[model samples]
Target: MNTTPPRVLTIAGSDSGGGAGLQADLRTLFACGVHGMTAVTAVTVQNSLGVTGFVEMAPEVVAAQILAVATDIGVGAAKTGMLASAGIIEAVADACDQVGIGRTGTTPFVVDPVAASMHGDQLLTDLALEAVRGLLFPRATLVTPNLDEVRLLTGIDVVDRAGQREAARALHDLGPEWVLVKGGHMWADPECLDLLFDGSEFVELPGPRYDTKHTHGSGDTLASAICSRLARGEGVVEAVRFGKEFVVRSVRASYALGAGVGPVSPLWRLEG
Candidate 1:
């Protein structure tokens, strides 16, 4: 019997801190029982405090990595994070279109829409943001953007559930199959809510709001988890639900690692 696990790919940056980026992505994928592959787009110099600096890989190099993985090992589902520039965004978008979406096989794509770090360091530029929408958004199976990102992408202030609906609609106009507006930053509330819109209906997924500062890689973990579930053939709603549970559990298990905020622990189950 072929016991090969489902494969999921992460096209994102590399975090030297080991708390986020490709590191977090791989950990989450493994925890979900999937094979994790990477197409590194940038190398970030960062720690718990924040990103000190970063160097983006060339567009050609980024494309090469994706092609190498897609043609050889194959990707069941893929997620992208921190494509820092327009060139990289276009390259990754075009590559995914041809090698993943355009291919006869199904390879679902998840867009994390990482605009900044938890510490408030900008990751995506204005040019890159436009490129992401114009080039990548149309090809995405799902786009998971936080409140700030939703505001950035749609120019709507999403302070409540009402705003989320408006933003989701505006975002859907940009052209993704589904939109998940993450409300994890709704700091004033005890209950955390994430809104999912599939161009028809809205699903409100609410989870326990954990008060923790170690949420450094929470976004990456959630997106990776969703991609992993999608690779296993779960529906968009199912994958989002699983992703939320995974992130909340991971956040609950968060612990301090460095001087600043720590990361959500992907190994929450094994450690405790």
Candidate 2:
């Protein structure tokens, strides 16, 4: 059997708290047994409490990082997280297009529309939302978005199961081959339910809703895990299933770090 690990790339911001952003992506990739690479789009001064400030990198710098990785180490799959600006989003989309990402390209790509934090701090601008939907969504093997992001991208406020279906179709219209509407913010039900749409059928992934607030990096972790599975050649549906299972385990084993919420440890399975 071939023993070489798959290589996956993450284009995102840096969270100083080590609980989210690139730090979380790298940790999740490592736990999923993939070699992780990165292209920092911004540096955020954030912690368990909240974000104070952030500075986005120049579009050229972000493009250079992606190009450098694509041309040299190469990537089996890639994921995009917190792109802070329209210019950065366009740049990343362009670079990924050149390097070939998603169904129309050589590599599979996961797009996590990370527009806000768990604590509701805005990480992406209002104007950049259009860029994300237009440039990145079409190139994504799967696009993961929470309720707020769903409304932001598709103009549909999803509250129930029917609303979720509507939101998924709206997002599909924007271009992603598949869409996973995250249910972490669904307060109506005690059980967590994620809806996955592939433009035809909907797959409902249900799990026990944990009553904890220490889910700082859950989104990043889930997206990166999906990317890692795809890097290892798993199909999109299988990748999403594995990602949800992995996140449930991680969230179950989460512990407090700071005064506020802590991150879900990607290596939780190894801890036991």
Best by lDDT: 2
Give candidates' CA RMSD values in order: 1.6, 1.5
Cα lDDT tens digits, model 1, 177-221, are: 999988888776578998999899999999998767788889999
Tell me how candidate 1 scores on lDDT. 0.87
All models: lDDT?
A: 0.87, 0.89
Candidate 1: C-alpha RMSD to true structure equals 1.6
Model 1 bad stretches (over 4 Å): 102-105
Report the number of the highest-TM-score candidate. Answer: 2
Inter-residue clash pairs, candidate 2:
none
TM-score of each: 0.96, 0.96
Q: lDDT score, residue 12, model 2?
A: 96
After superposition, candidate 2 runs with Cα above 4 Å error: none
